[model samples]
Target: MNTADFIKARAAALGFDVCRFASASEPWSAGERLAHFVEAGRHGDMGWMETTLERRAHPTSMWAEAKTAVVLGLNYGPGHDPLPEMGDASAGYISVYARGDDYHEVIKGRLKTLAGQIAARTGEDVKVFVDTAPLMEKPLAQRAGVGWQGKHTNLLSRTRGNWLFLGVILTAAELEPDAPESEHCGACTACLDVCPTQAFPAPFQLDARRCLSYLTIEFAGPWPVEFRKATGSRIYGCDDCLAICPWNKFAVASHESRVQAREGLVSPRLADLAALDDAAFRALFSKSPVKRIGRDRFVRNVLYAIGNSGDADLIEAARALLDDPAPVVRGGAVWALSRLMDDEAFAALRSERAGGEADASVRVEWAADQA
Candidate 1:
């Protein structure tokens, strides 16, 4: 077998479900799409996308030595349907990928190992990236025949569907490139129809500001208010549009042990998550990606979910957080209590809390609740 074939075999041996190569100089339109996306303000708070455009748009621009691009996919298809639990308002819906070990952690070492193997076989410089770098993995994956970007703007195929993690290996070796995959979406609008916030502006365009994944995971501080109720109980990342994809029927459950859902993270109780202090939050999420959001941010999301829960039993949890030191968390608490409590009780709590609150943002949240 040649170098490319050897690498594909090695990737399969290393647990990758699909491995394909694309020429580093392969022409693509991701640059134009990205520029337009950023210029249109669709990227929201993700300013990094703008800064990384030079390298992300074109592979050769990032590194002139980059000759072969290897895009690998690891299946993380959920064992069971996630829609039912997502439907339960009292339960917080953590996206399926995040319920397990962090993909960056799980996939990084493997990529490095594979990179080392490639280096040993062929004397060439290499860089392995697992979603950290600016390199556009989905576009590269599409160019490499691994998958196509679905209507949700996530990499998906009939084989891996929407539940796959991508890792890219840029090498100096000149490997034969594979034929790219064509779009299979046909006239399907399942993903488009399922978005609670209508994030997609058109067939392939996505407005990240209105995306649940962006609001719950990427966007900092409090949510945009208008999208909070539309977010439902999604405390972490979201999977609504992805779950609605028709190609998912062919997906196989992830075989990797580390990708399996952790005990309580799949769909946690809103009240329990709402009560987590910083220490408890850190201890629970340790190596998980959810830890990156920090206790305050995570709790803020929980409060939004609790308010939307319509579960009167969770009122005490929301009320207990009215005095939270983190203004963002307290702001979310104000919103939740306003939704769960009657006007008289909510008014009294708001009156007591408003005098001492320092953050103008939180104060605005408190005042808004009165209206």
Candidate 2:
């Protein structure tokens, strides 16, 4: 077999569901869309996107000698739908992508091994990336025939639905490129309709400022009041769009043990989550993708869900966090109080904020709730 055929076989053996190659040239069309997304401030506080503009547009700019870009996809589809659990106010919803071990560590380790094997055989230089680098993985994956970018702007494969994790290997050797997949979304707008925050301003576009994923994970300060209600009980990330995709019927459960859903993570109790102190939070999420948000942000997300839950049983939990060190958490506590507390209880919490060292942002939330 030729080198390309041999590499393809090796990729399948390595557990990659799909693999394809493309030139490390500028994905100019994607770059233009990215430029517009940035210009419109759609990326919100993700300042890193603004800094790495040039490198994200062209893979060659990231590694000048990169002649071939091999894109690989790992399927992480769960055995059951993850959406129904979102409505259970007692349970917190973590994005499916984060339910397992962190993909960066899991996928990169496999990619590095594959790259080493390729290098040993072909004697070519190789570098691998798995969401940690400035590479435009979704665009490259589409160009490499793994899938087309869905209306939600995530890579979607016909065989894997939208349940794939992308990784890239940049090499100095040129390999035969795969034909890019044609867009299959057609007139379907299921993803856009299901957005809790209406994050997509237009088809295939996202305004991160309003996205629950960004509000819960990427954005550092207090979440905007307008989106707090829509965030629901999703403490880690949102999966409304991905879960609603009609193509998901074709998705099969992933075999990667590391990506399988842990029992506690699949549907953690919100009351238990709200009571988590820093140490408890660390212990529970250690080595998981949810750990990246840190204890405070995660707690903030939980608080928003608690407020929307309207479950009076959770009132005590929200009260416990009234003195949280992080303004973001305290603000969410205030919002939760507003939603779950009676007029008297809210008045009591409002009085406490008057003499407290709460940030102006939190005070705004406190005042709004009181009003």
lDDT of 1 by residue, 1-371 (tens): 88888888999999998889988876778888888999999999998988887877887888889988888899999966788897789999999999888999999998999999899888999999898987888898888998899888898887878999999999998888999988999999999998999999998899999998898888888887778888889888889888888888888899998988989997789989988999999999988999998999899999999989889999999988978889988889889988888899888887786578888988898888432
What does candidate 1 score in Cα RMSD to the true structure?
A: 1.3
Error of 2 at 75 (Å): 0.5
Off by over 4 Å in 1: 369-371
TM-score of candidate 2 versus the correct structure, residues matched by position: 0.96
Supply the TM-score for candidate 1: 0.97
**lDDT per model vs. reference:** 0.88, 0.86
TM-score of each: 0.97, 0.96
lDDT of 2 by residue, 27-125 (tens): 458878888899998988899999998777788878888888889889999967889997688788899999989988888878998899878877999
Error of 1 at 156 (Å): 1.0
